[model samples]
Target chain A: MAEAAGYDPLGAAGTWRHQRAKLVVYTLLCLFALYYVLPLGVVILNSFRDLPDINRNGLIGLPHSFSLNYWSLAWDKFCVGGTCAGIEPFFFNSVSMVVPATIISTAVGAVNGYVLAKWRFTGSEVLFGLMTLGVFMPGQMVLLPWARVLGWLGLTNTTSGLVLIHCVQGLSFTTLFCRNYYVNIPDDLIKAARIDGAGFWRIFRKIVLPLSPPILIVTVIWQFTNIWNEFLFAVIFSSGTHQPITAALIALSAGGTSVHQYNVESAAVLIAALPPLLVYVFGGRYFLRGLTQGALK
Target chain B: MAVEPVTLTSVKAAPNHGRMLRERLATILPQLVLAPSLFATLIYVFVFCGWTIWISLSNSSLLPDYSISGFHHYVELWSNRRWTIAYTNLFLFTSLYVIGATAIGLLLAILIDQRVRAEALWRTIYLYPLAVSFVVTGTVWRWLLSPSTGVERVVHQLGWASFKFDWLVQREMAIYTVVITGIWQASGFVMALFLAGLRSIDPDLVKAAQIDGASMPRIYRRIILPAIGPIFISVLVVLLQFAIKTFDLVIALTGGGPGIATTVPAIYVYDLMFQRGQMAEGAAAAIMILLALSLVLVPYTIWKNWRERREAARG
Candidate 1:
């Protein structure tokens, strides 16, 4: 992992002092890693443990008894806020909301990026600046207006309404990602395509679209994870069967009386977290790229 | 010459009227393509912000009323005890969270940059928390921090019967649990950002410092950290925003609780707007949150732009 560029030559081969320093470094790294992974490991372990075992052993211990029963129970049988339909419907609500929001926002953002980057019109820079302001606008600032707007549009308390919110809310981020990327694609390419009598759509389809996959992946992962995990909007805009997994997870964990169902709740939490976690594991490079670019820019 | 003839032939082959229409369409195509997003963004940014600002200044309650009012809601929001607690909590959370996360992140980044083995594996472990939602992070931490079922119980079972890790239930200390969880979820992100910044620093500077017999710590303090100063600012800004928008994390973790001890501006906004039907004050609280964000963001943006312009001019 040591590249010549940034590698410290001071920590050269075969010195006890250097070796001791290395040991300290590794130890610290491992300790921090344990702190980072402990919660996830505990959750996974408790999800399969029997409730009695969890109760006896406490949440932080290794399981004494294991069963797959709670996974299915959390999926289909456990009641959340008096509804025994489990997390299945809310999971579907998230999926249905996330997929379209991701796709639509990415598609629109690509075109917006292409136009802003390649087809500079008068005042387009100012327009781009104004649009990017949406990136920093707090979600709280928009809730009242959105409530009124959704009411006006007859979209209150529906998954479709959440989908609309995500799309519009995600536009600035998606546009920023794609536009920064598209800026790197030489203008000469677009000009050449144009001189060949390729119209705007044709150039976009043939030239720009081919270069879009990297940014598109980043944008999609970003949008998917963000929209899926969004709680404030999900909690406020939809409820009951219409609620997304995040809000439902809150209700599920907060709802029951008597002894807390640690097993099922752990399983449900993992289920809610699974999609984005899978995306991160598979697309980590793009995910980090999106994060860095999104933050630094 | 070859390209010129091809273009001329294409122009000649197309019917004049059809070609003009196509030309017209092509001229407008980019704008047409951009129209919807532009319209949506304009509404999302300008219109929504304006509407909220207006509502905050109005007498709206239970529902929005369009009649103009003064800063009555803002006055009410400032004078309220819960709002005061929430705002103070926000200030405390932002400072501690930002400092704690950035310091830990920078430390981790420096450690990893020492050419560690299995760097990718370590990075993945550290950063995976960021992939999960704040809700998930908060919920999991809540379980782990709760005294009855979590760390305290586990420690007690290990034979320390007098152990007490019950910050989740203690009103004055409940906010610190949120801080701890916030640091856990976000510090790794700061590490990733700092790691990238560290990797981009010129190697020759480090080599020269080493040749001058400067120790590693001295080299880092005097040379490497200064080189990545811009990243520190970026990290600060991002973490500040995260701190300000800390809704779901606190909601899932403590529910702003141990009796309103952890109530943040976002939670307060939600309560007023939705639960209590105080829309105008809610809007005002929301605007306060917005104001706090803009106060941080606006100057940073202008400074960033000015710095970029200066760099370009220098180049």
Candidate 2:
């Protein structure tokens, strides 16, 4: 078996055979990439086109002219729900919901994770396991009861209500992330601090918190993206002025029974998507690492 | 100093007591930190699930009732036409979405592994969809696939007047539009996982195969794919969980329309519980979803535990 084949099967780079293969690979990749990119491109392009142009040029055709009318309308004038105010107010609501939820959830997860990873007590693993199981639970499973709970607390239809639900739900994932990351930290540092008469909080503040920026980045990015894009809870719990970008996006796009305004809908979609899009672009590897580890691990 | 000798034992005992108290506090601190999350999870996951079970069993309507009852709602749920359509769609969508995402993801990963230029650009292009909310994906895809205004209209305008891609409006073909959007959204995630798996494999394996007259496809089939089998299972588990809980996408994309053609269990659960105010039947539908998730997740948990034990034993 070792002596049968003498030549290199892969061949040198840029050889004719390899070139043909390269062409095929690039072509296929470009085609699929276009599949993903074209819709987005169309959204951006169509966002600039006025309603008349969309009707004349078709949704995918090159714009004969461009205008900023749709973006402004989507942001400032387009009616969402009963409010004639545009997505701007809902954008603020989402920020109000997402910021607190992300910070609070990540903080809770970090503390829980630090304890679960470093300060292991009896049945700690079982506790951790149960928490992780919450991550897999479908939102529908908890929706009705959670809503009742929120309503009982008089927090329903408030940004704070959305924050509370997201924080509660996000804990499992944040805990999982922080705990897994902390597992790789050497135990000796903790023991050394313990020998020096440090307690749990002191050691965590001094030793663990400093070592946490990486996991915190992962957790925050994950939570922010999730809470921002969340629809079901936001739609059900919040109404009127408190709806987030996602829920508002739905109301805006599906607002009219009249002819669907492709331009305004495209603009609204892009506006709602902008924050997460920016995060994905800038957060880069942290986004991928967070999602992959969050899913697979 | 000499007079202090009698008090030395008491003094030492005092410090010892303080130390013991401090140690006990340290021991309790972790549990205290962990208590909120534990309590939340217990209430949210288990208690809510239990609540749904109770509600499903009761003859509750619009509001929860305390009296215990039989599986009347479950029976009704099973008999309902909408519920049946939703149940069938779950299986159809899950299978197609999972299979399509996995296949495309693996294909993209293999192509990108061939030392392609601009790898980062390609990866970003693919993975960007994962960041978009399902709401957005649904809306965007709805626009793209709509018959009168989307691709069909555009293609027709491009001078192929006979083109007919109106799956969004057709009752029978409506669900497949969801399948397409689901794949478009998830294939990038699948590809990322497969690419990670591919990158982790030793180059020597490929080299060895090449030296032995093995073609690229043969090498992938025999060696590369088998080695990454766990990733495939992981991807399937993830995608199935996604499929089972898919509501936002369907809601935004089709609104479960063309008259109940694209209803999944999640949408079904939401409609009965929230929209129709049929609390008992909705809880029944939700439990069905929980069971569907369990069908994938229970074995997954067992497999994970088994693998951990095996690894521990090896160590």
Candidate 3:
């Protein structure tokens, strides 16, 4: 409304020129929106099309015949390894990896954030700054050494290993998220709790923890989507039965010596992409809020 | 209940002890909670980075032998033609992708800022790609760009018989196809950031500019754009690091293929370590990638610190 007021006084005072410009702007926005939507749209439509029809009519064409075969095949029969078992196993791997990683990272991050916000030690700010540095550190810097470290610990090629890796890597972002959210909680409430002879954990348990649902939701959704969609770590660290859907999707779609099964690939990618897509559809505002918090300030 | 006589020293010492205990716990509590994540960062980021640096200088291969060498891997990495191509591709992709993503994102952000209807729907449509993995993004784009079943086929069906959009298989221009997909995936994310920045700008400033008889474009150019300059830098730094670490996208899309046309340092590092079993050289390439990241990140950090200091000073 304020933005509307700012522009309403001089420009677009009910003129033909203004209407024309408005049409152009709306058209461009629609076109860009379409551009962003087209690929996913193509995938969704192609997922239902039979393979032969897809090859005949191209990606954007109307399906000559629709088949749910690809989805069933993707779920039951797409082969990434020697077994012809579908992406079902890998999807479960992603779930197992994502759920625990999200919970652990979010819990650890909440405590870290609480302390960083409320209980400032001598070097806490310095520590916080150092942790923030992890956010910008490229995964390339640690991939080789990390693989070696995981092997040394005998945890390589396991879901737990991937979970641990994600939880650790996720600390920077989740802690930052929780810290920013907790920073806005009034200090008086915390001080009052301190006066009531409550210890640190007690205050957090009774007061701060109750106030954490919004940030927890944001952090969980963020970590879930991130871990679910993560590729680099999953590819290098997990193989065979342990690979997450992201890695498995790559293998199923284009990895190894296999025929390029575009229909199956489309269905599997849609399956791979659907969880986060649903989250965005339902939790768009929260997702946007988390992003802006992490990215902008 | 009988009142007991309490010594002054007893009362004084009791509260003092309580205070001291509380103070000590306060000092130690945060460290206790923070230790796990800090330890993880220490091992994963700092220690591993140091290990990488050391390995880069050593004669490690296949199984990571720990003999100290003198930059042999770096020398070899630089001299290899494939490495040269990957390195060049890194810069090329970074520049084009950063510029393209930022431009398109800014354009979309501005377009969306026009008080449009279905704002949330538009935002969702534009932003959904960011939720999908790069692997999927690359795979989908690869399929869409393939000649037999993709853009070329569709356009040819539409009677543009000469239409040929086969950059996915071309050697000279394959990198640009990666750039295209990168832009497609990321531009919306950047747009979200820019839209947030645009929304946060004080509307009063825009009003003042409008009252000065400036057109909307002029007002934006002279007023709004400069106000949100920091966001552009932030987006650029973030995208720059992304560009440096690009691996899965290029792998799934191009597989560094058509004769290694789309190879980047990340892929090269992966190939060396995992595929070729050249651990030391891979570590060396990894370090180089870290160096490239630091080049962007270090300056961004300094700029942020300076800006924070300036804001504090102003306050």
Candidate 4:
């Protein structure tokens, strides 16, 4: 195959035909990339540019003025809904809600995955199938019940309530991810551990836990981004100070202000997006791994 | 060696009893660890679904009333103008969004699969939108699509005064705006999936096809795409589900506005239950969304299972 004329296995031989194909390919890819990056770039630039500059440049042009004030204002001074305390509180609300929810859901899911993959009690497969049904469940179906549940628990309109809701809702996905990953671990290793007098927790601690960091990271990133970005629940269950950044961004954008504060709102939107964006940039490999596993399975 | 047999047996039995107890604990531990999640899923999935279903059947309003009202809300929901429009819009949005995203995604994936330079950078750019919340995506897009400050204004300022991209505010065109933003947000995800599918195709097949003088497009169409047929279905099902549950995007993008022109079933549900205090009707609408999702998902799941079973049996 390598000896054949004009048959480049590595695809690096720059025949005229190959060069033109590469040109077309790069052109299309760059065009699509521009479409994807345009909004983000506009937002990023507008976030730092003055409102007057944005007004003059119509949001798609080079910045005439730049300042860090909008970031600060969006952080602590600008009003969202009725509060002048800015998006700071709501950002913290997302943080607090996401952190515990991610940890609890991931921990519980890790154990559930371990049991479902390794323990294999009778009917466990059925149980897992039923649990995974939660993944496909629309949030609308559970809104009324969740509202009532939260009310009964006296946790309505609180971040704790949102955390509880997320942890429960997130379990199915986390469990599915971890279980799928854990199923690939050879059974002989577990059997060997069992023969060595290792029990359930011991085997998990010594065998499974060490091999879990990859899936664990994937699950954490998945759950973190998801819970942070969750809107329907945040909007429905919480209000005002307790709302996450997603909900607050809505209020801020639609705050019925006569004039849109493009700069500050832009900064606020970026603030809301920063966490997941950072996660995606850093753990992109695991993020995509999670997405594929979470979607296809 | 001279020890009594009774003492030896007693010691052995004691250790055996302890070992049995330990074994019992080990057997139960997994169940114990697993029970909470199972219970939670049972409540969250089955019970919550049942609860909503019940509410949809009841005449609940202002607050939940347990009294069975016998599908009155479902009837009312079907008759409602907003609900009808919402669902009709959902169908349109779902079809367009799914097709558009999948087509664009397949193209991008194929393009990237040419072993493009800076593949990671390009993939990151395309897929980054999935990282941001829909609220953020919608907000940025809403800005860009707004006539006053968005593309229209920029084009108008740039020596072209007749440019009109006011779909965001137009009553009839608002839904298309949602579809566009959705495709923008989701196509990357589909692309990622397709790229994976493309990469997973056996190299020899392509090599053989090339040796047979098959062109690239022909090779992709006849060989690579057919190989990734399962991925196409997966992407379709996933995108359909996304379109069905689309609330945040619509809320942030158009707020189901231009006078309910863009009202999706999700926005309708939220409006009915939270804003209008029509809880029963809202629950009914919510069920409709679920039904729509299952309509796409059930067939997919069955086919997947059947395919797996056939493969297993063959193997």
Candidate 5:
């Protein structure tokens, strides 16, 4: 009836209006994209511009000359003593910490999810409840006591300390995901296995593990992203020698470095973003599938 | 019930051993699978959290001995003006950020759900910030808001001299700068959550509303919003948890400086232990945070479990 009044919901005027609205939304989203991507853009664009270019050109300008000087500067010269200690070492440090942390937590969480889902127990729910609690505790509360414990155990300021901290922090959410997803599995399969004289570990290893491909992927991606970019615990547990790139980048933020270091900063920033961005783009479908399965509850 | 009984072969398995061993393995395997998580949880809670609580009661420093000093630390934390200021700022910070982030994120989610084009592109736009670590973002935003050599400078040069984009320098506004930076980084996560929630609404409800001659806004208000209530609760809990732990941005942007104007509880604890050499005071503040977190989290856990259990029983 509305269309009959020559409103032309599908005609030129209607089409024009719809197209204009779409263009407007698209423009706004593009602007939002800029807002979201600026830190990265700034870092990447500036990475190529050298010291004088950074100084003369200001932050928003197209560089008159591009150089790898600042990446070299960050790598070789940014240290207090001017040793040209490039970001390469920190890159290796981060990879080492994040990989072990991600694997341990995700593996543990997968096992946890399988058990909680497939088995009945007197106190399983209580254990699950505690896992959730550990997930939310602020990092600050744990740092001091953690320092003492680390000092006592002689792991204080080591890669293992950072890994332990990240793993502990990552556990609660991973467990939550595993538990929620495992709950969605059927009971009959477990019963059938039990009837066949399979034990709990065997059934979990064979049945529940195979059935958990989607969630396990999600858990790995989430933990991997989280630990890769984790800053606070990295800062607290690491010092000059064993620092992750995040801790290294943090120096630029604390200032007294250079006001015109925007390009250098942008380049360094881009480097930090590379790991997770690659994960999302390459494995985006798996990423979203993981997100939906883990977070939808 | 039929399977719950042991059969003649089960009797032989139980008595003769081979099958009984298999049965025991079946039952115990789940527990074994549970061991690593249980071990991690115990260490996390008992070792980490327990030590945190112990330190909170004492006069321990950077190198704490764990020896008790009664409630002196807690008393100092309560009376100290700086600590009080930090707590007040954090309270206001968390409250405003959580509420604003959720409201804006949900609005964006709704707007995006209106059959817009290039949805994946839009989502990436919003979510790309999450990929930027706090280290880079806090500095970039700080530079953007800088009084002299930043975006503000460019705008001023374009003949907007009256414009003072210096919230970061002003003591009163410094905390707000951190808040803005935080929301910019985090609102994307909330948007993603709301987007997922929005996607799950039954199409039939929307069609039903449309057939009744209800307007789009009315449909959303009455039908759409309610369907997403449970998700709203999830976003709320996650947001609240996030708000409680905000630290990185403030540290990066202001370092809790300009006279500690932007100081928050987490920063305060970090300052005491790492920077100020006030280990006991830091410990006390950590306790206060735990107490505050529990004040919300414990009740929340209980309420959620009760609701879930009630729903299960009803089902």
Candidate 6:
């Protein structure tokens, strides 16, 4: 029924038709790829132009003359608040907070995840489920209450609070991924360790921990990216000195100076995007795996 | 923080309690490791949420008040023009974003799954947005879409003079524009999930379908779709949660402006608390939004978990 009409209805060779179909599909897929990609290209190109050049050349146009002037301007001589500070401070703040947060979150996450996957206990699934639920709740809706909590702790507008929030938030999804991933590990390794008289802690520390390096690396990269780009909590709980790169980007964009410097803003935007872009370039495989298995799982 | 094994202290208090202690330690370790996270959830969801619910009933202003307000704020919310627009816009935004992201994301996933060369590069290009906060990406989109001083004005100069892509400015089209940007920032995530699901699909099925003269689209629609149905549901749930709780894109992009055209429940609640200083109304609106999400998410989660338990039992 499926094949009778296609064999000779058009009187074309089967090979010819199949080749044509392949070519068409390939073209369509490439076009779809372009649709996903061209906007980013436009952004990259637009970032290099000056304000006047942007008006003259348009966003889609290639820059007639590439200049590092906007990048410089965005970094220095940009009065953020009564002082000349560029995104440098924001970059520093993001690194300081995100680094500690990423490390702490992933570390605790590893243990929590290890326990969940390895241990069979009462209400374990319930604990994991609740963590998963927290992951689904968007940070904006929860930002206020968190900020209030932080304020009471005297951590509001501080680096400590932002880092803690990131660690806490990173717990749910990270633990979920690590747990699911660890579940697939064979049980015989633990059993063998027990036979060797290895303590539970030693078995986990010496055997399972070292073996799961790929996933741990993946977890670290993903959480670093997560903490780096976090905004709502950054905005709510931190101030200028403690803000992440994202909050800085927002502050810069919203507070336009001198006829909406789109090129500089674009440059700043591109600058803000660098860490993530670089992370993806280096660890794209791990990022994909982590995303697939994390909250989505 | 040390991972030292405990002697099952509770059971160790009894003599010759070795076997019982092992059992007790096994039970206690998971809960201890899980304690902080569990306590956080209970406090955040149960306690603060309870407080939010309580305040919605009381005359809580910027400061707390114990006096009862009844259904006053809810009635006011029903009457507020901006809140109504916000609710409608939220519905539209969520619908468009969930649909658009899933569609494009699936296409990307399928293409990548089908032995695309330099898959890592392409996947990276798609998923890079997930690394940036929505605010940063939202700012990027805002600039791209702004009527003046953005790509809109530039497109006019490119000799296509009638390119009226001013959806960001108009009331009716503003929400749609936000949806487009939302999809742009998020579909990569959706694509990754779909790709993972696609990879787990048995190659034999594709081979068999091809042997049967089933075209790619037909095979995908019939075979792949059903196989990936659970994944589809999961992705949609994530997308729905995102679309409903959307705030940064609207705030960073439009500020719920052009006459409240792009406001969602999130932004509506934000304005009530921060901009308008109407804390009770804001809390009420937030509770309403939470209730709406819980209505869909809580029940669906329960059903999915139930089905999952049954399936696991079968296995």
Task: Quote the chain B TM-score of every prediction.
Answer: 0.95, 0.93, 0.91, 0.93, 0.86, 0.87
Q: Which candidate should be chosen as best, given TM-score against the real structure? A: 1
Off by over 4 Å in 6: A1-13, A191-197, A256-258, B1-34, B66-68, B112-116, B213-216
Candidate 4 residues B1-315, lDDT tens each?
576455555466655788888768877888988988899899999899999999988879998898999988888888889888998999899999999999999999888777666778888999999999999999999999999988999999988988788999999899999999999999999998998887777788788887787777787789989999989999998898788899999999998898889998899999999999999999998998899888988999999999999999999
TM-score of each: 0.97, 0.95, 0.94, 0.95, 0.87, 0.87
Q: What is the lDDT of every predicted structure here?
A: 0.90, 0.88, 0.85, 0.90, 0.74, 0.75
- What local lDDT score does residue A229 receive in model 4, on the 0 to 100 scale? 95
Candidate 5: tens digits of C-alpha lDDT, residues B1-315: 356665676456436577678668766777776777688777777677778777777667756767888888888888998888898888888888888888868877776776665677677777767666777678777776667756777676677878787888999888888878888888887888887777777766777666677766677799888988877777777666666777777877887867889888888888888988888788778777777777767776777779889999999
Q: After superposition, how far is residue B221 of candidate 1 from its true place, in Å?
A: 1.0
Arranged by lDDT, best first: 1, 4, 2, 3, 6, 5
- Tens digits of per-residue lDDT for model 4, A1-297: 011222233363348878887788888888888999999999999999997788778978889997999999999999877779989999999999999999999999999999999999889999999999999999999999999999999999999999999999999999999998899999999999997668888999999999999999999999999999999999999997889999999988966746999999999999999999999999999999888877766
Evaluation by TM-score, superior candidate among 4 and 5:
4
**Candidate 2 residue lDDT tens string, A136-201:** 888888887888899899998999889989998999999999999998989999999998668888
Cand. 4 TM to true fold: 0.95
**RMSD each, Å:** 1.8, 4.3, 3.4, 3.7, 5.0, 5.7
Model 4's number of clashes is 0
- Could you tell me the TM-score of chain A in candidate 2? 0.94
Worst 10 residues of 5 chain B by lDDT: B7-16
Model 1 complex DockQ against the native: 0.71
What are the per-residue Cα lDDT tens digits for candidate 6 across B132-169? 76777778777778776566677788777887778888
Q: Model 3 over residues A72-141: C-alpha lDDT tens digits?
A: 9989897777768888899899999999999999999999999999988788888888888778767777
Write candidate 1's Cα lDDT for A1-297 as tens digits.
Answer: 335255574474348888888988999999999999999999999999998889888999988998999999999999988789889999999999999999999999999999999998999999999899988888999999998889999999998899999999999999999988999999899999987778888998999999989999999988988898899999999987899999999998865456789999999999999999999999999988888877666
The TM-score of the first chain in every model comes to 0.96, 0.94, 0.93, 0.94, 0.85, 0.87
Ranking by TM-score: 1, 4, 2, 3, 5, 6
Per-candidate clashes come to 0, 0, 0, 0, 14, 0
Best by lDDT: 1
Candidate 2 C-alpha lDDT tens digits along B239-284: 9888888999998999999888999889888899888989989988
Compose the digit string of candidate 6's lDDT tens values, residues A71-147.
Answer: 88777656554456777788888889988988888888888788888875777887777677666665545655675
